[model samples]
Structures are given as C-alpha cells and as structure tokens.
Target: MLAPFLIMLREGLEAALIVGIIASYLRQTGRQAWLPAIWVGVFLAIALSLFAGAGLQMASAQFPQKAQELFEAVIALVAVAVLVGMVFWMRRAARSIRAELHASVDAALHGGAATWGLIGMVFLAVAREGLESVFFLLAIFQQSQDGAAPIGAALGVLVAIGAGWGIYAGALRLDLKRFFRWTGIFILFVAAGLFASAIKALHEAGLWNALLDPVYDLSGVLPESSPLGTVLGGLLGYRDAPSLGEFLGWAGFLAVTLPLFLRPSAPMTQAVGQK
Candidate 1:
C-alpha cells in the first residue's frame, strides 16, 4: 500500500503540475480559449490509461498460475526500469520543463487549427504520465494484495490535486527540489525491492533454481503476515525470509543505484514560462 501510495503521489503530482502549468501559461498569455482543449486531452488520456490498465489486468487473470507469476515478474522488472528512468529524468529536466512546455504551447497556438494541435500536445504529454502510473500501480497491486492499496492510491491523487491547485493559486510554496530528491531516494529503494521480488517470483514460477539457498530466516521473529511486517512487505518489499538470489538482487541494486542517485550536483535554475 505504501508503494502504491507513493507511486500514485509522484505520478499524480507530475500530471497535475503539467496541467496547471499549461493552464497558467494560457491564461497569462491571454489564450484562455485554449483551456477547453487541454481539458479534453486530459480526460481522453485518463480514459485511455484506465482502459489499458483494465485490459492488462484481465489478460493476466486468464493465465495459468506459473505463467501469471512469470508475467508478474516481468511487469515488476519493467516497473523498476521505468521508475528508475523517470526519477532521473524528472531531476534533470525540472529546470527546463516550463520553457519546453511554453515553447510547445506557443508553436501550437500559432499553428493552423490550433485547438487540435494543442489537444494533441497535451494528450501525448498527460498520456505518457498516465501510462506510467498505470504500469506502476499494476505492478504493486500484483505484488501486494492488500485491499487498502487502491484507496491509498486514490488519496494520493486527491492530495496531489490539492497541492497542484495551491501551488498554482500562489497560496503554497513547495520546496520542490528537496521534495523530489528525497522521494527519488525512496523510489530507488522501492524499485530495488521490486527487483528482488521479481527474482523471487521467477523462482516461484519454476524458472530459476540456481540460488535456492536461504540467506537468513527472519520469519521466526517477524513473519510477513504480522501487522508491521505486512506494511513493511507491502511498502519496502520486505521479505521475512529471503533466498540467496533475492538477497543479492536487492542488495546489488541498492549498492549500485543509491550512490549514483544521491550524488551531489550543481544547482538547477527554476523553470519559468518565458524569459
């Protein structure tokens, strides 16, 4: 549930920021008439995301048990890859996103049939974010069958919407750099857990048996089904008793990725709508 909550929060905040920025830019430029087109694009993108998620879930349900496990493992790996790419991309691109969006908006406004052009631009942008959210949510849902996860995701989105509104309204000032930096680290750890879980699932599917040795058994102390254990398992991919392969996969990913993610770098300029 924690994993789903954070995933939804990050993805939702990103989409909300994009939409808010577009709306703000249009209003400031006296292009308020274009707002409807952006809404249309956002709604359409959301619909497509939902459709895709449902389709994937239904397809997975029909598979045999072992096949389903394998599929889940594959999805987890894909989610980890996507999450890693997104965290780095967001950090690197934050400084220039506003300018990029404004440039695109300016071109679309000047283009012939501006409404369709604007709609296409927003649709593609929001849809990309939406699709990524759908994949991540699906992966977490497969791993943790906790009933509260969907509610957590919904709450995260609602909070993100409020945050975006406050920021756009000039009533709130977020330290976006710090927020993103910490969340990126949190996501890196979660992705590492996913990587480890994926390996475990593959073994469960009767595919990988090379590292069947038990690393250590903590199930005797804090079983995964215990209250705290469940939360930890759902959020951090905590395994009470992990095999050698799972331990190695988890540790190896964090050892390599965490340092690179936390490395100090030059400060970035704030993203502005125009010069």
Candidate 2:
C-alpha cells in the first residue's frame, strides 16, 4: 500500500507540476485562451492511461501461469527501466525545465494550427507521466494481494492534485528539488526490488535456470506473508528465501544507480516549478 502510494504520489505530482508550469506560463503571457485546451489534453491523456491499464490487466488475466509469469517479468523490467530513466531525466532537466517549457509553449502557439499544437504538447507531456504511472502501478498490483494498494494509489493522486492546484494558485510553496531528490532515492530502491522480482519471475517462467539455490532462508523468522514482510515485499521486493540471482540483481542495481543519482550536478538558476 505504501509503495503504491509513494509511486503514484511521485508520478502524479510530476504530471501536476508539468500542468501547473504550463498553465502558469500561459496566464503570465496572456495566453489564457489556451487554458481550456490544456484541460482537454489532460482529460484525454488520463482516459488513455486508464484504457491502456485496463486493457493490459484484462489481457494478462487470460494467460497461462507460465505466460503470466513471463508477462509479469516483462512488465516489471519495463517499470524498472521507466522509473530509472524518469529519475535521471528529471534530475538533469529540472534546472531548465521551466525555460524549456516556455520555449515549447511559444513554439506550439506559433506553429500552424496553434490550438491543436498546444493541445498536442500538453497531451504528450501528461501522457508520458500518466503512462509511466500506469506501468508502475500494474507491476505493483501484480505483486500485491491486498486491496489497500489501489486505495493508497487513489489517495496519492488526490493529494498530488490538491498540491498542484495549490501551487498553481500561489497558495503553496514546495521545494520541488528536495521533494524529487528524496523520492527519486525511494524510487530507485523500489526499482531495485522490481528488478529482483523480475529475476524471480523469469526463473519461475522457466527462462533462467542458474542461481536457483536460495541464498538464505528467512521464512522461519520473517515469513513473506507476515505484515511487515508484505510491506517490505511490496515496497522493497523482499523475499524470505530469495535466490542468488534475486539478491545480486537487487544489490547490483542499487550499487550502480545510487551513486550516479546522488552525484552533484550544475547549479539551478531559477526556482523550480514556481511562477
């Protein structure tokens, strides 16, 4: 539940921030006429995301156990890739995102068929985030048995929407850099867990045979079904009797990605996601 909540929170907040930035830019530059089109793009993007998620879920349900495992592995791997890429991309783009966005808006409004161009821009931006969330949520749902995960995710989106509204209205002041930095670290851990889970899934699907032996058995002390174990499993991809491949995948991912993420970068010249 907590895992999905955080995942959605981060993803939803990113979309919200993008929308907020675009909306704020429009208002400042007397392009408020395009505001309604922005909302239209957001709605369409959301509908598409929901449709894609539902289609994938329903389609996966019909697969055989082995096929299902393979599918789950594929989705987990894709989620891990998207999550990692998003973190690094945002890290590198945060400093110039506003300026880039402003430039994009200018380009969109000046292009032929300006309304469609702006809507297309907004749609693409929000859809990227929405689709990313959908994949991440699907991976979470596949691993979880509890209903609270969905509820937590829904709540996270609501909170993120509220925050976005507040920020756009000038009623909220958030340090987006700090927020994303901590959440990016949390997300990397989640991705590492997913990578481990993907390895386990591949083994289950009869794809990978090596590293089948358990590295250690913690089931006697901390069964994966236990409440704490479930939380850890859902959030950090914990397993009681994890295989060598799983352990190595998890540790190796963190080992390589963490330092790269934490490395210092260029200084920001302006406040992020602020009007």
Candidate 3:
C-alpha cells in the first residue's frame, strides 16, 4: 500500500507538472485558444492508460496458475526496472525540466496548423507517465495480499493532485528538488524489495531453483501478521522467513544501488556575473 501510494503520487505529480507548465506557457503567450486541445489530449491519454491497464489485468487473469506466477514475476521485474529508471532520470532532469518544457512550448507554437501535433505530444508525454504508473501499481497490488494497499494508493494520488493544484494556483510552494530527493531514496528501498519479491515469484513458478529454500525463520519471534511486521513488510518488503535467494537478491541490490544514489550529483554552480 505504501509503495503503490508513493509511486502513484510521484508519477501523478510529474504528469501534472508537465501539463501545468504547458498550460501556463500557452496562457502567458496569448495562445490560450489551444487550451481546449491540451485538455482533449489529457483526457485521451488518461483513457488510453485505463484501457491498457485493464487489458493487461484481464489477460493475466486468463493464464494458468503457474503461468500467472511467471507473468507476475515478469511484471514485477519490469516495474523495478522502470521505477529505477524514473528515479534517476528525474534526479538528473528535474533541474532543467522547466527549460525543456519552455522549449517544447516554443516549438509547438512555431509549428503552425499542427495543433494535432501539439495534442499528440502532450498525450504521449502524459500517457508515458500514466502507463508506468499502471505497470507499477499492478506489481505492487500483486505483492500486497492484504487489501489495504489500494486505499493507500488512492489516498496518495488524491493528495498529490491537490498538491499539484495548489502549486499551480500559488496557494502552496513545494521544494520539488527536496521532495524528489527524499522520495527517490525511499523508492530505492522499495525497488530492492520488489527485486526480492520478483525472485520469490520466479521461484514459486519453478523457474529458478538456486537458493530455493528458506535460510531463516523469524516468524515465531516477529510474525509478519503483527502490526510492526506488517509495516516493515509493506515499507521494505519484510518476510518472516526469507529464502537464501531473496536475502541475497535484496541485499545485493541495496549494496550496489543505494551508494550510487547517495552520491551527489554535480553542484549547482551559478554564473560568476549573474545578478
């Protein structure tokens, strides 16, 4: 639940920011006539995302038990990949996102009578974010056997949308850099858990046998059904008795991935003669 919520919040905020920038730019440039087209694009993108997610869910349900496990494993792996990429990509790109959006807006304005192209661009951009959210939510939902996860995810998204609106309306100011930084770190741990979960799924499907057996049993001492255990499990993929493969997979991912993320990017240097 926590994982899905945070993932959706971050993704939704990103899409909202993009759309807000485009809309603001058009208004400022006296091109507000195109506002309707932009909205049309947003609705289309959202519809497409819903369709794709429903399609995948239905298709997966049609598979046999073993095949479904394999499918879930594959989806989890893909979600991890996409999640990691999104974190790093945003880390590197966030600083310059405004400039990029401005350039895109400028290009759109220059391409006369290509209103549909602008719509397509917005659709593709928002849809990319939406599709990624869909894949990630599916993976998280699979891991969260209990039913609380969906509620958490919905809450996160609703709050994020409110935040986005606040920011746009100048009613709230967010330190986006810090927001992403903290969330990125949190997401890294989530990704590590997903990696472990993926391995467990694959093992369940009989696809991988290495380290197939449990290494230690902690359930008696700290049962996963307990409140603390449940929180830990939801936040960091805690298992009462993890297999050797799962332990190695989680530890290995954290050991390698966390450090690189912790490392600082280039310092934010300003021009010597700047105001």
Candidate 4:
C-alpha cells in the first residue's frame, strides 16, 4: 500500500506540476483561450494510460504460470529501468524544466497550427508521466495481493491533484527541490527492490539457475507474511529467505546507482514555474 502510494504520488505530482505550469503560463500571457486545449490533452493522455494498463493486465492473466512469472520479471525490469531514467532525468532537469516548458509553450503558440501544437505538447508531457505511473503500478500490483494497494494509489493521485492545484494557485509553498530529492532517493531504493524481485522471478521461471543458495534464512524470526515483513517487503523488497542471486542483484544495483545519484552537480537557480 505505502509503496504504491508514494510512487503514484510522485508520478502524479510531476504530471500535475507540468499541467499547472503550462496553465499558469497561458493565463499570465493573456492566452487563456488556449487553456481548454490543455485539458483535452490531459484527458486523452489519461485515457490512453488507463487503456494500456488494462490491456496489459488482461493479457498477462491468460499466460501459463511459468510464463506469467517471466512476464512479471520482464515488467519489473522495465519498471526499474524507467524509474532509474526518470529519477536521473529529473535530477538534472529540475532547475531548467520551468524554462523549457515556457519555451515549448512559446514555440507551440508561434507555430502555424497553434492549437494542435499546444495539444501535442501537453499530451506528450502528461503521457510520459502517465505511462511511467502505469508501469510502476503494474509492477507494484503484481507483487501485492491485498486490496490496499489500489486504494493507496488512488488516494495518492487525489492528494497530488490537490497539491498541484494549491501550488498553481499560490496557496501552497513547497520546497520542490527537497521534495524531489528525497523522493528520488526513495525511488532508487524501490528500484533496487524491483531489480531483486526480477532476479527471483527469473529463477522461478527456470531461466536463471545460478546462485541457488540461500544468502540468509530468517523466515521463522521475521516471516514475509508478518506485518513488518510485508511492509518492508513492499517498500524495500525484503525477503525473509532471499537467495544469493537476489541479495547480490539488490545490493549491486544500489552500490552502482546510489553514488552516482548523490554525486555533486551544478546548482539549480529556479523552481518549476518561475517567471
């Protein structure tokens, strides 16, 4: 529940910020008439995302058990890759995103087909985030069996919508740099877990035969079914009895990725919607 919630919250918040920034830009520039196009793009992108997610889920249901496990592993790997790319991109782009969007808006408005240009701009922006969310949710849902995950994801989206509105309205002042930085770290952890799970899934699918030994067996003391274990498992891919391959995959991912993520970079001079 918590894992899905946080992931969705971050993804939704990103989309909201993007739409809000564009909307704010339009309103401020006396282009309020073009605002409806943004909504159109947003709704369309959302519909596509929903459709894609449903289609994938249905398709996976018909697969045989081993095939399904392999599918799950593939999805997890894709999610991890997407997530890692997103985190790093945002880290580098955060300071310049506001300027980039404004430039995009200008370019679209100046184009011969202004309406379609704006629509396409907004659609691509929102769809990128929406698709990212879809993959993350699919990976999370495949691992979780209870009813709480969906509810958590829904709540996260709602909260993100509200937050976006507040920020656009200037009713809230959030340190977006800090927010994204911490969440980026959190996402790295989640991606590491996903990578580990993907390894386990591959083994289950009879694809990988190496590292069959148990790295640690604490199933009796802290079983995955236990409340704490479940939470840990969902958040950090905690396995009470993780095989050697799983442990190495998880640790190796963080070992290589975390340092690069935390390394020093150029300073950010502006927020997402600065004038």
- Candidate 1 lDDT tens digits, 54-168: 9999999999999999999999998999899989988888878999999999999899989999999899988988888887888888887678889989988888889888877
TM for candidate 2 is 0.95
Q: State in Å the error of residue 12, model 2.
A: 0.5
Question: Would you estimate the TM-scores of all the predictions?
Answer: 0.94, 0.95, 0.93, 0.95
- Between prediction 1 and prediction 4, the one with superior TM-score is 4
Top candidate (TM-score): 4
lDDT of 1: 0.87
Residue range 159-223, candidate 3, lDDT tens digits = 87898778667788889999999888888888888899999999889998898689889999998
Clash-forming residue pairs, model 2: none
TM-score of 1: 0.94
Clashing pairs in 4: none
Angstrom error at residue 240, model 1:
0.3
lDDT of each: 0.87, 0.91, 0.86, 0.91
Task: List candidate 2 stretches off by more than 4 Å.
Answer: 267-275
